[model samples]
Target: MTRLNSAATAETQQSWASVLRITEVAAGLPSSEARRPATPAVVTLQMVLEKLQAGWRWVERKRSQQISAKRLRVAETISLGEKRTLSIVTVDGSQYLIGSSAGGVQLLTKLDDATPNNSRDERSQ
Candidate 1:
């Protein structure tokens, strides 16, 4: 009788372990096969250097694009008097004479592509 009881207990424990394993699978836990160690990633110095160079090239390209996109620039500025000044600004391909005082800035005139003397004459008039 004791022998039979021990056999039954062994069978019950085996069935319980199997049921727990099935429950774990249903709950999306990693199985023994999926828990195996993954292959190590191999990185070389050449790989690292290549990645760094590509990153620098991208940064340089972006910097050059930003510089090229600048269409407005102050060509020259002159002080007219106290709190007053005159400036020549270039936008795209056109130049403009700007006046700045304590109150605000004003666009005096657009300078032409003619000689500097002619531009000055036009501004004076």
Candidate 2:
């Protein structure tokens, strides 16, 4: 066999790290526009861990090829220390939290999207 290139070795290492990273999971209702808090919201680190795990599990299920398992969207995204989120409540009320806590909106995507609260109308789909 040919010798492995440095880039290839590095890429292989990266993949393992991603696959082995612990996923945290948490629960927190979105800060509704109607219920925007005058003060900051405080959630425990434990809660954050839960949400992160859930988000990672969500991605794993999606990326997996198994047919005997399924994971539904539960929350849009859970928040990290920064603005990054680990979970999220998708339109239709199902959350679609993400595992990678690196960037993007922490708790929402679009305010206009209609959810289960609506009739799946133009409000959000």
Error of 2 at 74 (Å): 35
Q: Per-candidate TM vs. native?
A: 0.56, 0.22
Count clashes in each candidate, considering only residues at least 3 apart in sequence or on different chains.
0, 28
TM-score of 2: 0.22
- Residue 109 alpha-carbon offset, candidate 1, angstroms: 0.6
lDDT tens readout by residue for model 1, 75-100: 99999898999999999989999999
lDDT of 1 at 49: 45
Q: What is the lDDT, from 0 to 100, of the residue 106 in candidate 2?
A: 44
Candidate 1 residue pairs that clash = none
Runs of candidate 1 with Cα error greater than 4 angstroms are 1-43, 117-125
